[model samples]
Target chain A: MNITVNWGLLAPILAIQLILMVTALTSLYKADATRGPKWMWVLIIVFGQILGPIIYFVVGRNDRS
Target chain B: MRQFGLFYRKEMLEMARSYKWIWVPMVFLLLGVMQPVTTYYMPEILKHAGNMPAGTIITMPTPTAGEVLAQTLNQFGTIGVLVLVLSMMGIVSGERQSGVTSLIFTKPVSFIAYMTAKWASMLTLTAAAFACGYAGACYYTIQLIGSLDVGTVIQAGLMYMLWFVFVISVLLLISAWLPNSAGVAFTTMAFIMLLSFGTSLLSRYLSWSPSRLSTIASEILTKVETLSSVGPVLWISLCSILICVMLAVYRMQSQESISAKA
Candidate 1:
């Protein structure tokens, strides 16, 4: 149980998740309209972990709007 | 050919504008990287689960690199497919709903060119994402698990890529035939799940099915698959993809005539 996990080995994974979230959040901010409320998507993108941003990108953003 | 290139470029631009270019591949990379890392840490992960008796030794066989890579493919088969399908579900239906298809139809656009362009763009994105993900998985597997044969990995990757091709083709056909994006997504997901399940349950009767591509890919990784054994499935997959594309093109052409008469 005392095994020390190397942060270096795990950094890239966390970094990728951060990149996804940042991109999703930026897109949400710029969009004038989304499928649902803007705040709801902001919440989802930030709290939805890896899948949060993906869901927002796939279904949340209303391109027609 | 010129018209196809134009439509293909437009589709790619739309994908880039929508940020599909960035996020889809990122998700794939995350999925690919997590698999090998988690497998390498399985013992530590299980040990930290708690409630084990004092001095209880967790004896686990280390999985070979090929096994780890195959497990990565399984991860792609489920979650990777979902992300890819959902991202693509609206390709045709969305354009139709937004009146864009009608607007374009008013011009001298051929439905064949348009449909083929859409299919080609989707296949491009899928191939890029899969390649990035698989390469990441290979690097991590070699570093964390062990070394894998390069030939085996490439062969397995090709087989698995063909499965994605088949799935995307089916999705394209459904999106063309359906009017609603949600419906397109639902039907495609259901059909895929059924095909995968039925293939496994009726493996004897459906050995040549495209659904067998995943199993064949895994077998290749494990060195249990031969070229002759994979030939039928590969041929069937390519043929089905061609059929789906032709059917979708026909659907679009018929719809064009109907709209023109109206």
Candidate 2:
């Protein structure tokens, strides 16, 4: 099967990366997360790249419990 | 151990009573039933539909039992992983937030034992669901197709269960350690998915990273590879589970260091 994608695909990739980066950096503002939550955020950011950080932003960034 | 059993039974009962446990496995059963039932009748069902485009006919390859199994695993496997992660997301975090841990901790039982029992219960449930769901699909396939190699069927079932168990342990570990179970579960699921996609960009050599358990699970269903040939894959899977469990225990103990503001 021949499959192809245009360079335009890179646009979404770059956009997602930026969104993730911003979310990760902003999470420190939420609450006192202890080292545990903070490390988890970093793990999510590095490993999750886009989705990890995005999910953290949506669900975990609060740290409010 | 008896205490563990008593607690396990109580925990199991509690989990069962909540009705949340029904979410994923039941959906998986539907996926299983849909496999053979859909493949057996999809053409006829489509043909019987009310609207038909003139001169346009829906044509598909006559799906075999293998194809049905493949389709079921691929589809159910993806959704199953998501559901398992999501449902388990709240188990640990909710307990911590609600002071459930304190209730359990005041007892004479070691924290490790309590965590282990809970982890064991979830792991057992995860394995049972994976087995039952796929077993249903396999049995249905045999009913439709007349015969399949029992050895192949059992091997595939075991492989699939192992794949899912590998994933559940990660969630278990994350949920165990993270202050927020739901948050960790969601993040862990996202992490696995992202890793699966990210590895694709790297090399096919790393394609069998434990995160690709879903892909490998489905593939093992349709292909031939002895457990021995798949040893490296299995080893990585085991290692991943072990590391996750260890980290979770470490994290749980570490949680003690967090000042109780609540």
Candidate 3:
């Protein structure tokens, strides 16, 4: 198997994923409260790939104020 | 105007504090970029999924840059709009339900200022996020698929943004008029879906409908339609937004009595 994965093509996708992950983690770290348990969110953020961070950001935090 | 400024700033701060500033645009950006990337990789993705016959060859026509961008807008039209609705459904009704509106109303606040401030912040968020998402999609489309005319993209984007403004205004109006946030979201979604679907079904009669704005936007991108043809629809949409705001302000003003009865 001589499959060549172009780094140039894949770099932006990786970068976007990284940004999402970091943002989710940072928000989780600083959040005063969330919709559910913080540890569950941490696990979801770590393992959920592209959608995990987005779900965390969208539905996890309880923005009551 | 000063009151509007103060309220707008407060709204911005609330958005920032709630991490809406960070996440909303990021989600849009993700949605925008995903279309082109996934389209470019579809063949390889299918191969990896491993249900292909031994000698089957997949030959798919690579979509034009314009088509890829249109697909991105389609993503926005569905999932992106859903996210915006879910996030913003509580902007007015939720506050009312929580008694925050009562506290704010007791102060010497202009109802117009309050409504306009909410409108302005929603517009800013939508515009900024849409611009980021569309730009990202354009960049990836050009790199992976083909070239598209910048002017066409901008015109289509502006048209789409106008449709978004109209939708958000409808949401704000519903949120103000309804006491339940879930009810507000559902009604807004149903209204939007009906508008789009209904107009498409009766295009000849409803050519001037605001829902046609989405179709006009896509047609502009694909070079199948021109801006001049969309003038009536655009004007109607703008007028509808203005009407929505006025109705929202009126509803908010009467909210005191409504809440008292509730």
- Which of the numbered candidates is closest to the native, going by highest TM-score? 1
**Native-vs-model 2 lDDT?**
0.65
lDDT of 1 by residue, B1-262 (tens): 8999999999999999899999999999999999999998898888888888989998988988898898999999999999999998899999999999999998988888999999999999999999989999999999888889999899899999999999999999999899999999899999999999998998888888898999889888877644336778889999999999999999998997898889
Model 1 Cα shift for residue B9 (angstroms): 0.4
Tens-digit lDDT track for model 3 on B1-262?
9999999999999888767777788888888988998998887886776677888888888777888888899999988888788778888976777778888877878999999999999989988889889999999899889989989999889989998999999999999888888898899999999998988898888889998888888888877754335779989999999999999999888876565466
lDDT of 1 at A50: 91
Per-residue lDDT tens digits for candidate 2, residues B124-179, read 77876676677777877787654666776677677777777777777877787678
Alpha-carbon error at B105 in model 2, in Å?
2.0
The Cα RMSD across the true interface for model 1 is 1.4
Candidate 2 ranges with C-alpha deviation above 4 Å: A1-65, B20-24, B48-52, B200-203, B224-229, B257-262
- Model 3, position A34, has a per-residue lDDT of 92
Cα TM-score per model: 0.97, 0.71, 0.92
What's the distance in Å from true for residue B32, model 3? 0.9
Q: Quote the lDDT for B47 in model 3.
A: 74
**Angstrom error at residue B259, model 1:** 1.9
Model 1 pairs whose backbones collide: none
Better of 2 and 3 by TM-score: 3
